[model samples]
Target: MQWIPDWGQARIESMVANRPDWCISRQRTWGVPMSLFVHKETQELHPRTLELMEEVAKRVEVDGIQAWWDLDSRDILGADADSYEKVPDTLDVWFDSGSTHSSVVDVRPEFAGHAADMYLEGSDQHRGWFMSSPDDLYRDEGQSALPPGTDPRLYRLMARAARCPSLSATPFLRRT
Candidate 1:
């Protein structure tokens, strides 16, 4: 990924190295559910977690996210239902935006299997989407999502333009 001012990548690297692990689940009553079953006693994912996720995905495709909330654990788990429970937490908002390459881009007919050529955003996202996307991609795909030598552009608002309101109509300034 390209950072226009060039230091953007370094800043993100430092943040990732120093930051604690991010939790990708939330307790919200609404949202895309994590959609997996876990062993009730061990608190570990069911051995068939992936298979269960696939079943949920099919239902979600046909019935939307409600499919997950409405699911009856017994229907899928049968006798195993006694030992496992569905994960109630929904995926954090970061999971949605951070995993767009897989959830959105990879599903498209034209963009499937291709990495994004560019990711353009304001400086504020450097700590949010900017860092989350690559981190998520690396975990999911085990490789860099952007091709080598792509433009590294980072555009930031000047101090007055970002914080101080002014009547002047001067264009926002940025460094090359």
Candidate 2:
């Protein structure tokens, strides 16, 4: 919740400038419905039917979206059947991105314990995945980048010596 930015006036300007028309229609039958309604006589979608949609969403979480779809007119419009009919379009992109990690990685045990040695990206990554991946890695490892009680400066020096043993050798060894 704290992650959500309050854009306020900036949000309105951004929306006005970048608001491309979104195709709300989808051919899918699964997942959350678009929560619109069409008039039976006029064959046009009703604009004010989102009030009923909020009520339907509460029921969907408990009983599933199919329950709303299969409901009679009385239940669909909740006592206002003359004005509206439920929209059948559900978002296809919902399943596309929603289950990415689970669908791609978790099902294959080979990938389960594996991790990327390094992630190469443009400078944009400094603000994007690079910032987030470390937090995820730390959470997965159950500790910080260095183990508890280990000084990072000392660890780096040790690592450097480990990689270049000549630097760690004594001057007396030069005679040999």
Candidate 3:
């Protein structure tokens, strides 16, 4: 992958080599829900998780995300609702952003079965989106996220711009 600024490649390589595995779940009021059912006592996923998730997906497609929140556990779990509880955690922002290849880019009719050609991200994303995106792509497709010959670039915020008045309302970057 091609990165702007010669040092960017090394910086990203070092972060990837040293960073810890990211946690992909968080308890948040907003953001994509995990929509999982776990055993009340054991906290393990329900045995029929794939089937249940498909059911949830069908509902979500028709009614949007609020359908999951409004749904009663019993509606999906039947009598097992007493033993299985819905997981309230939402996916981490990094995980959600990282999976955009499959979730967004790859779903496009023109781009089916292909990876994105470019990924524009902030320089700070080396330890966040940069790492997570590649990892997710590799896990799902068994290859690096960037196709051969693709260029990946990161832009850093200008220090002076960050200190400017709030009226600017945008982080200016010093593109190299």
Q: Highest lDDT, which number?
A: 3
| lDDT on C-alpha atoms for all candidate structures | 0.72, 0.47, 0.74
TM-score of 1: 0.80
* Candidate 3 structure, TM-score to reference: 0.80
What ranking emerges by lDDT with the best candidate at the front? Answer: 3, 1, 2
Displacement of the residue 52 alpha carbon in candidate 1, Å: 0.4
Candidate 2 Cα outliers beyond 4 Å, as residue runs: 1-20, 94-176
Count of clashes, each model: 6, 0, 0
C-alpha RMSD of each candidate structure in angstroms: 6.4, 17.5, 5.4
Model 3, which residues run further than 4 Å from truth? 140-142, 145-149, 153-176
Per-model TM values vs. the true structure:
0.80, 0.38, 0.80
- For candidate 1, the per-residue lDDT at 153 reads 54
Q: Clash pairs of candidate 1?
A: 2-152, 2-153, 3-152, 4-152, 4-153, 4-154
For residues 1-176, could you state the per-residue lDDT of candidate 1 as single tens digits?
45666777788778888878888889999888999898999999999888989999999999998989889999888999999988899988766776766665546666555565455556676667667777765654587655565444555556665565542222111222
Candidate 3: tens digits of C-alpha lDDT, residues 34-107: 88999989999999999999999899999999888988999999999999999988999877776766765444
